[model samples]
Target: MSGHSKWNNIKRKKEKTDGQKAKIFTKIGRELAMAVREGGSGDPAVNSRLKDAIAKAKANNVPNDNIDRIIKKASGEGNSDAYEAIQYEGYGPSGVAVIVETLTDNRNRTAGDLRHYFDKFGGNLGTTGCVSFMFQKKGVIVIEAEGLDEDEVMEAALEAGASDFQSDGDVFEIFTEPEDFSAIRDELAGKYTFVSADVEQVPDTYTAITDPDLIVKMGRLLEMLEDNDDVQSVWHNWENADDAE
Candidate 1:
């Protein structure tokens, strides 16, 4: 499995904790709002971003009524002006390149908070494009592999334009070019139960941070960013397995 996948599994394992679930809901809600605003419609059939957002919400077990209410409000143009997508680049502990994706109403507040968090956690936020060059944006889809054959899935995914396929436990992850995401997703829609699907910047190479203290500091920084309402996702090049027990 990729280091990204491993770190995700660790986070997922932690989601059962009460405090973490609240943070997860906040992040998902922000994503839904941003998606609805950007797509300009709440109808999933016509809005690709909204469709993905709904899928993610369902995956996280977000309340159906809450999801519907958000869509209704978004469609009616009440909160559309309050959200904007922003990207931030930086270096985490041990010089691990990091990229943060956020949807915020107040850019200044988000920027200041992010910088403060980085400084507090032994990292520094850099200007745009400073660390992004070390990564490539790609679409990743994770599906339960209970009823599917790994080899068959791999073959199908490759034929459907997937760039890579990996099995982590009973989960199968399919990666594709950003443009090919919807095509691959549509092809496998009914064949598997998709756990989560999203576009992310995958680091081209990892910075192996073997020091335990540095790893703890980096993880703390990532958690802090993830907890922020404006922050949607955080990506970095640090390989945690080298230091994580």
Candidate 2:
């Protein structure tokens, strides 16, 4: 499996743990708020960010009523606080580069929490742009390949302007430029059922960390960062250990 796919699978497993679902909900809520604030419209048809947020919320089983209420509240002047999107760069265990994307009402609180997590996990949060250069922003869509032919899927994705395509087990992952995300997704709407689609910072190269102890520490640090209400996504360059079972 590719490093990106492996990390995604690990994230899926982590989300199944107790209390993590609530964190996921908070992140989605923040995303929805930001989308509404930026797009100036709550209608998904005119706001791609809002559309992606709603899709993610629905995928997570967030209730329709709650979604509508949030959108309504955001559209009006109802307690909708503007959130600033911040990106923090750092190094995790084994000197692996990591980038954290967060939407926060207070930058101080978010920065403090992030720095503490990195320090506690034997890593150091660096200045902005320190580690981001090692990665590229791309839109990734993962779909179930249970009954679909890999070749056919590849053809469609390529025709839709995908940069790369790969399969691991029964899942097919499609990568495209950030600008081409919506078009590619629309093109494949009726052709494939996607497991998930989101924009991510993909690492150009991976740092291999084989020690089990350090791997556990890195995982804990990542989990803590992800659980923060302000944190939207975390990207790292650590490769899955070959001995991981």
Runs with alpha carbons beyond 4 Å of true place in candidate 2: 5-18, 241-245
- Residue lDDT tens for model 2, 11-34: 464447557777777778888878
Best by TM-score: 2
RMSD of each: 2.4, 2.3
Maximum-lDDT candidate: 2
Reference-based lDDT, each prediction: 0.80, 0.82
Clashes of 1: 0
TM-score for each candidate, following the candidate numbering = 0.89, 0.91
Record all residue pairs in model 2 with backbone atoms less than 3 Å apart, i.e. clashing. Answer: none
Query: How do the residues 131-198 of candidate 1 rate in per-residue lDDT, one tens digit apiece?
Result: 99988888888877788899988898898889999887767889999888877887877677777677
TM-score of 1: 0.89
